[model samples]
Target: MSISTSAAPDTGRGPAEHDVRTQIIEAATAHFSHYGYDKTTVSDLAKAIGFSKAYIYKFFSSKQAIGEVICANCLGQIERDVLDALEGVQAPPERLRLLFTVIVASSLRLFFQDRRLYEIAVAAATDDWPSVQAYKHRIHQLVEEIIQAGRAAGVFESGTPLGNTSRAVYQVLVPYLNPVTLPHVSALHAEAPEALYQLVLRSLAPPA
Candidate 1:
């Protein structure tokens, strides 16, 4: 019987494959954070992980694929944090405020610390990838829940379908939440986040 030394590229196919893939993602995240996505190469990653360049290819198809994995992990973390903050909050407006504050602060931090993840996120958004679309859709639903809650509590405007109003809010906040525009937003420092948050809240509320 001949012994095979080569292992095929697989994702979640087996413990061996999953472990290798996880190792690759963890190592790739560090390299990308330090050198950025554009500058980091598969060979560099393989060298860091003590694997051959071909072995890195066994788990990830390209640098972009690896970046996507990183972005997913990072965004999932933010999502979990956001959901945790929303728990046990009875006031809709208060919940919305907390949501935006955490989102802006976390996004800014993510941009500074792991810009490679943000860069790949922007690219994914630009390309309109399905996974990204689903991600955004899920986020949109969460925000929509808040909007609906606010409407029920009489803190937000009524008569419009919740989806329409929530989507409009999402569009306005896209500058802050969308990775493609994050760099541009970071360049400006004219207004405080509280000011921006209040402005967004005002847009949703009816005149006194």
Candidate 2:
């Protein structure tokens, strides 16, 4: 992806600051992913795009802050995919199906585009990035709400544990849809996402 840049402001202050900040983030992600997180430096990030380290610092206080922003942006993209799928669908099953399909497709596509970045971010995630973690929880809550809806409609079996099922679905996905691991599992090549979805649905669906 091209690193989008912002024009310098006449007043030397405005949303351009925010746009420049985003540019720094985009550049940092590309650099950090290409070179492992440990190897990437502020000078490298700044020089990679012909900007100065001082200039980058004006926006990001530190490398960790930049990493947090990039990590949060990745989660935000996933949230957008979920919200887009949730829009316009009223039926619980169809809505749930769409949510599953969109997340799988979008995640797979994104991971394929930059597996190293995701890998690095995943490693960093265990350290507890609250913003990213919160976004992830929001997405999980959205899925849980859909499960609850399905239960209310009687389309899915009643009395199913929505929280546990939602967590299970999350587990099945993070590995299955991930590009780094998908190649090792042969079944994942054929109908991985659908199979996983069916498993979750079976657990949560009302009695036959």
Candidate 3:
């Protein structure tokens, strides 16, 4: 009886397929973050992770597929956090505070520590990626939902357009979430993220 000790290459299938896919995603995310999407290639990722190009191909049909997964993960995380903040919070004002605190802290972590991933995700999002756009729309909906809830609960003044305020908050916070943008905004406002968070809150604050 001959003993076969060589392990099979990853094919991204079967019961453990999810785990293999996750591994591939992690490796590809790091590569894309470091070298950027345009500069990074499937070959580079395979080489970096000691996997055969064929194995990677089996997992992801192309680099774009991997990028889609990364984008989905990023957006899903943000949605989850926002939803979590909204749940079990009675007061609309308190809900807004919780949401902003969670989001700002999360953004700070992503911008400062995982900047490469942030950059890669942001780039992928703007290049006509459908998944990216959908994810973004979901975030917009989250903001809109918060604004609507606040209005209905009488926490935000009536006649104020929640949609417009949602858009404003998104536009203002999105760019500042970038580390590069942080310094520029920080100098202007001093406390940067904190100030921006407060500014958004004040803008939405109900009368007196």
Candidate 4:
């Protein structure tokens, strides 16, 4: 959940400067929520926040920069939720199932309940924003971790290299995870997670 302070305004380090940066982000998020990311502009944000466009520029280089922070925050919440759901679950099989279920549910909730914010997510994915790339890498790592644990427990076959297996599994989850792809597959949304999880489990099963 740690956002890179590198994105912070060049203003000197202090509580006051920090507050100003936060104010800009908060204001931008609210504006984007109301008007949608594509329709909003830095000038519009400055007007809303009562700061000049130049002042706002000191904090963020572009509209996408501000969106990146908001997108990171949203994706961070999903990662936290996934971690919380996995907490205290010792069984890799169950953990894998929960991972699929929780992520899909969380994503669907965001798409349905917060369409405006979801617009930002869609932009992030389409534009190949750094935050979205980092999120995908983390999710891939989580899958690899679960696969490694499964191998240790002898519940999953070790014949396939771990990297290949994990990547294959992650690819299967991409349609559900990628904001841009999720809507296209909406018809399968309800049943795909469980069906995919079973298919993955079978693939990972030890040979007879």
Candidate 5:
């Protein structure tokens, strides 16, 4: 007598596994959009995805963990837009200009197109989300690259350390980039981006 055996569950990132994960993320995005992150729960996510809560647990540890992934995905898209915009810019100043413009435009578009995406971004800024810092660091890295390019080209002065300078640049734009403040800013002035961008450029200028 032989015992019947079944294949183990697909746990890897094979096509089938990837498809299921994508489905979950999509459903989670919709739920978070309609209900807001604070109101969304693991059970709601699983139900919306047509999977058991235990099934979601098998992949993600908690509801917050899933939200963090969604935030990271949005940041990844923003990074791609920044890189794409920078490609045609020949000068560092121009690269910096495009970087700020593209990001602001992209953020506004994302917020207006689906305010839920912006809400998740706001959580990243206001709450101490674990994965949020990584995305912020990635953004700062892009800014530093442009600064370094400018220094090499003799277009700008770099008296301070590049790392410190980059941090200052990103921090100063908190109002414009921080999802928490971004909407308010936009609400007051729809065309405030160019004005804010001027301030960004001034920050990078060498002291006289």
Candidate 6:
């Protein structure tokens, strides 16, 4: 999954307008971090940035629109981290392991380090935000790509349909990947990711 810029619809504005939009996003990020997303309103952001509510609306249609951009940015960083971890790893097994480990660690770091920003991710998942959906789709695509590579290398069995295998692997990852379920699983099964990763490797292995 590549790092995506923003999930919000592009306005096709000029550079000056784009600068204003970036300013609005940066201000909103700080405000959301300090005050929490649900507690803060667009009016609050306008005041914090010395812009009128009407002026803020020129950049974002609603508070949720601003939240979507922040959420996309957060998820994008996770994708970049995963890509970096997989760099120079030719083995499909190692690639799959890094994909699972890096994503879970990155998410946990976000939850602990910038918890308020993490709340935005929770809301995105709960509300079925487009950014969340797109993130999940990209993850699924990555899993499928790894599975294809493994099959081509004869590292994984080719009997199961590719789509089915990919979805199954993704399902195994959902508990860790989902913001809502992550804390719960982490609390109960801190070692679940490693255990699950090994299970997946065995399941994908070609018959003896």
Pull out the clashing pairs in model 5: none
Candidate 1 lDDT by residue in tens digits, 48-165: 9999988777666677767666666666666767788888998888887877777767667765675555666777678865556656777788789989888888898887788788
Among residues 3 or more apart in sequence or in different chains, the pairs in candidate 6 whose N, CA or C atoms overlap within 3 Å are: none
Colliding residue pairs in candidate 2: 156-206, 157-205, 157-206
**Global lDDT of each candidate:** 0.70, 0.66, 0.64, 0.84, 0.70, 0.83
Q: Which predicted model would earn the best lDDT? A: 4
User: Please, what are the lDDT tens digits per residue for candidate 4 over residues 90-137?
Assistant: 999999999998899888876656788789999999988888888899
What stretches of model 5 exceed 4 Å from their correct place? Answer: 1-17, 188-191, 199-203, 206-208
User: Number of clashes in model 1?
Assistant: 0
Candidate closest to the true structure, highest TM-score: 6
lDDT of 5: 0.70
Candidate 4 regions exceeding 4 Å error are 1-17
Candidate 3 lDDT by residue in tens digits, 67-182: 76676666556556767877888776666666656765655545456666766566664574666567556666766777788788876765667677889877766664433454
TM-scores of all models? 0.78, 0.74, 0.69, 0.90, 0.81, 0.92
| Model 6 per-residue lDDT tens digits across residues 1-208 | 2223244444213232376777778888888899899999999989988999888787677898888888888888888899999999989999999888888888787665888888898999999888888889999999999999999999999999999999999999898778999888776445767778899999999999
Report how far residue 22 has shifted in candidate 6, in Å: 1.3
Model 5 alpha-carbon miss at residue 101, Å: 1.1
Model 6, residue 36: distance off in Å is 0.7
Error of 6 at 91 (Å): 0.7
